[model samples]
Target: MMLENKVVAITGAGRGVGREIALLCARHGASVVVNDPGVGGGGEGGDAGPAQQTVDDIITAGGKALANLASVADPVGAQSIVEDAVQHFGRIDAVVNNAGILRDAIWHKLSLEDWRAVIDVHLNGAFNVSKAATPYFREQNSGSFVHFTSTSGLIGNIGQANYSAAKLGIVGLSQSIALDMARAGVRSNCIAPFAWSRMTASIPAETPEQQARVERLKTMSADKIAPLAVYLASDASQGVTNQIFGVRKNEIVLFDKPRPVRSMTKTTGWTPEAIADELIPAFRPSFARADEVSADVFPYDPI
Candidate 1:
């Protein structure tokens, strides 16, 4: 009962990781608000069945829960999700920004429409929900924000320029919120989850390697990511803000925020030639490989 008497709002709770988190949070004593417009993988079309089903599951389990069919991409809709939680439950304790859509494309071929579509739902959507919850969090003097990021952004990926940009932007958003709200007893953190879901299913699997990767991913269930998210949403994670975590099946990883790994300071700012000779050589060994993608960074099977 880590979350007894608490209320949590979770976006994208219709299925997959979001659904798992919502259900687990309710089980741990938090009144849950399950929000999902039930859009397809590419953000096209919508339905209410997914969100309602999650709510039904929670209620059937004897937990307090409610369903909210709203697109997090819409500022007004996003606000309603938070407002609904407060109106129904009397207070809000945590917000999980998990709604997302994929429109993967290589950088050269990526269109403006796809770029905006991805950004609107992922980066802007996260901001919209978090912003709507800020006042309540500030007044209550306690709240948590658990944002979903991805290795496609944290590490690297192929043909996901828009997705990568939005995901990385969310990391920055999470960090900034953590720093800005620390004094108000608010916490913000990110999770780079590795799971097989509708999002992953959209990845092109035409090649042998790509198909193999998908098969490997199928072994990792969406539920495997819920425990850490539930912990972050509860009082148990006090003093655990401003962190980025990776959840791959049974393994959990903490990531170091970007910092100077190798430094070579030129007292008198060097010319281009001098930098080429000295700084480049000094930093070469520490430089990450330009070709490495998410799979390369995590070559082993999920543990």
Candidate 2:
């Protein structure tokens, strides 16, 4: 009953993590707008059954729900989807920016088309939906945004330059929105979820060993990632914003933030030799550790 009477709009709700989030929200008493473009993992458009099916399941369970087959990559479509939620539910309370596409390629092999396709859907898609929902949230003086990021983006994955860049961009976007909406009672947070979904179907299983790894990963179902999302979308997370969370199985981990390791004094008459001697140790990657001697030692004494 945490989400009783709450109205939430979820992009990519047709299947996978988005679908699970919609179902969980409904189970807890939310009225959901299940939006999906019916696109494949690569963003090719197709049928609308996925979104409709989720809505049907929710309604069957005695929950309020609606289906929207709109491309979040399109600003007009994104706006219309939010408008539909407001028109049907009479208010918009939360948005899950979960729609995305994958275009994997090494940096040199990556085409402009491949890069643009991923960016358009994942990065621009979040922007389109968030922008459309912001006015309503501002007007209502309350809203929550759960933006989907990925470990690929957080830690950098192989052959996913396009996908990783777009996902990381969502983190920056959510943080900025969180700061902007602080006083408006709107909260925005990023979720890096490790769930076995359609997005990872292309992972190969050529050998029994490979298949075993895949099977192990499958244990982290999409359903397991939904509860954290529902909490973030509810009133319980009002004080939580501009944060990043990693969700998998029964564990939820918050990612640590970055901070400057050492501050150097740039003084006049300092030569390249002086810079090499003093700053080189500070520039070492190990200096990133707070407990490292170089990081703990003050390179320059203050007057």
Candidate 3:
């Protein structure tokens, strides 16, 4: 009963990882708010069935739950999700910014429309919900935020320029929220999860490598990510914030934040030519492999 008497609002809870987290949170005694517009993988069209189904299941299991068919991409709709939590449950304890869509295209061929679409849903959507929930959290002097990031941004991926940028931006957002809201007893953290969800199913499998990677991903289920997410939302994880974690099947990993790896300085700062001659060679060995993708970094089978 880690979350007994608490209320948790989860975006994208209609299906996949988000759904699992919502169910688990409810089972652990939290009154759950399952929010999802039921949009497609690329953020088109919508249905209310998904969110309602999640709530139905929770209630059948003897748990408290509510459904919200609001698009996280809209600020007003996002605000409604939080408001619904407070209006119904009387208080809100956690917000999980898990709503997202994928619009994959190579950097050059990626259209402005596609770029903005991805950012609006992933980056701006997270902000909208978090911003709306902030005042409530601040006033209550307690709250938790669990944001969904991805390996495509943390490591690398092909034909996902917009997605990568949005996911990485979420990391920065999580860090800032954690720092700025600490005095309010609020915690924020990110999870870069690997699972065979609708998002992964949409990845292009044109290449042999991609097909292989997709096959590998099929072994990991969305439920494997629920435990960590529930823990983050609960009081048990009181001191854990401003961190990044990865969950792949049976494995859980703590990721290091960006930090200076190597440094070089000249007593008198030199010209570009000097930098080329001195800096390039000194940093050559430490340079990250430009060609490495998520699969390349995690070549081993999911365990």
Candidate 4:
């Protein structure tokens, strides 16, 4: 019972990674608040069925759960989720900001509506949920936050400019939250999980070769990622804040925080010409090659 008696609220718990996290948390003895607006995969339309179904499943497995239908992007709605947890379960020990939607388009072809939609759901949604829940965590003097990020943001992707921006924002946001709450015993960490969730399933793979690749990728199940989220939510990973972790099939990756790979300082301000001559050549060897992406880093399944 790693999370015994703990109350945890997970957004987007209706399906995919969020669904798995809720189930795993409950199996580990946590009372879960499954929050899902039941929106369509693109964040349109809604239903209560998904959240309710998850709750029913959890209870049937001998666990406590509450169904909450609140869009984490709405401040008042997000606040209601925190309040719902406190009122129903007595206290909330963890908040997992797993709510998200996908609106993928190439940078040149991306629309403003699509951009805002993704940002609001992923970035603002996380902020709203975390902001509403932070005061309680501060007062309780203990809590954990697990924010969902993606390798698309960590590295780069062909399309998904909005998603990449929003996910990277989560990384920075988690770091700041971790530092700000360290003295209060609140830990925040980000995870870039490579699993076959609804988001990945949406990718069009029409060619036979692409279809076969997608089939092999089915091995990377959402359930495989739940254990990491469970550990991060439990006391086992205490004092491990502000770190970014990646889970890909049987492999786990620890990404290095941004640091200068090579540095050259000019004590006196350098002219543009001097910079072109010195800086360009000095850093050329260390420069990242063009078009490196997440898939390239871990293309094959783990041995």
Candidate 5:
């Protein structure tokens, strides 16, 4: 049992990816807290049915779980959710920051309200839950955080400015937390998943003849994305942190770390024209691949 005796709290566990993760964790021997406010895809208020349903499913599968009906967007509520996990299961060993909402629009057409609502739920909600769990993790001297980013965040997507920004912010946050928690035996990583979740249901099929093609391309199941997450949260990945992975059907690609390129040294000032003509080119998009240049040409030197 990879997660024997572990305690995991997952936000948005009422449905979709979060629910899948909760079930998997419980099956591997973890005591799970399925947290959700039962909100719909648009983030509207609702009952706790979704969360309870997940719990019932887990119990039926012979797994241990508790349903938590709390809004991840509320810091107080998030804190209480963690407290409930500790109260029921003794300690929290991991957290899956999987709660999110979407508001899609092109850059110029996006309203302030639309942007704020998405950012509040996706980015701020991650903060609320992670902030509450950090103390517990530090005290235990070990923990794992699996944050859900998206391909829209990694690359870019039309009609998703708000969602992309929020998801990218989570990746940055996860990296920083990885550094802060390194010595405490904690690990943090993000996953950019391509899965068939409720969030992508509205994407239009480009042509009637291409309907099957569209369905094929969009039908990567939530279960397919969970194994990588499970590995990251388990003990096998103790040495891995501060990384991002793109997971889809039968494929997992590691994202590259950011690197600097094209350093220029000048002992004297240059004219604006020279700066524009020379410096700009050195920093152009083409220079991004300069890291692959022959290392022998820039051999290590001691001064």
Candidate 6:
């Protein structure tokens, strides 16, 4: 019962990794707030069924939980979610920003609507919830935040520019929060989970072979991602902030902090023409090819 007597509010807990995280946190003796507007993978349409069902399951298992039907992108809705946790459970010790939506489109074909929709749900949504909980964390002198990043963003993916941008932005936001809240005993970290969820189910299989890969990946359930999330939400991960961790089945990967790999200098300065001629040639060998995608990098069996 690492999280005994603690309350953790999880966004998008209606399904996917968020749902698993909520269930695990409850099992670990934490009061849970399952907040999800119950939107589809594309962020279209909403239902209350998923959130309520998760809450019901937790209660049936002899755990404390409440259902919150709120869009994480809505500042007021986000604030009320945190308030509800406090009023019902007395205090919130952790916040899991797992709410998100997908709007996949290649850069040229990506519409303004698609870009805004993803950013609103992912980046801005993280802001809304974290901002709402900041004062509470500070007042209580402690808290934890586990924000979701993605390999799509960490590496690169074709047709997911919007998603990649938002996911990477969450990492930047988490790191800044870790720096700000360190002295208050509050910590923030990011998780780049590689789990099979509805989103993966949505991937179009153009051929039988492609379809088989997706089917095999189905075995890598969202449950695998929950353990690291719960650990980060508990006192066990205290001071383990500002780091990015990955969960792909049983494999746990720690990404190095972004650092400069190469530098070019001139006693004076180099002109754009000079950089193009000199720097480009000097660094081109180290630059990752634009065609490389997530699958090429993480070829391990998802199962």
Report the CA-based lDDT of candidate 5 relative to the real structure: 0.83
Error in Å for residue 293 of model 3: 1.3
Rank list by TM-score:
3, 1, 4, 6, 2, 5
lDDT of 1 by residue, 34-55 (tens): 9999999999999999999999
Q: For model 3, how does the per-residue alpha-carbon lDDT over 157-176 read when each residue is reduced to its tens digit?
A: 88999999999999999999
In the range 72-121, model 5's lDDT, one tens digit per residue, is 88889899889988999999998889998887887999999999998888
TM-score of 1: 0.98
Cα-based TM-score, every candidate: 0.98, 0.89, 0.98, 0.96, 0.88, 0.96
Where does candidate 2 have its weakest 10-residue lDDT segment? 294-303
* Number of backbone collisions per candidate: 0, 0, 0, 0, 0, 0
Which number leads on TM-score?
Answer: 3
Candidate 6 ranges with C-alpha deviation above 4 Å: 207-213
In the range 72-149, model 6's lDDT, one tens digit per residue, is 889999998999999999998999999999878769999999999999999999999999999999999999999999
C-alpha lDDT of all candidate models, in order? 0.94, 0.86, 0.94, 0.91, 0.83, 0.91
| lDDT at 300, model 5 | 27
Clashes, model 1: 0
What does the lDDT come to for candidate 4?
0.91
Q: Flag regions of model 5 displaced more than 4 Å.
A: 204-214, 282-303
Regarding TM-score, does 4 or 5 come out ahead?
A: 4
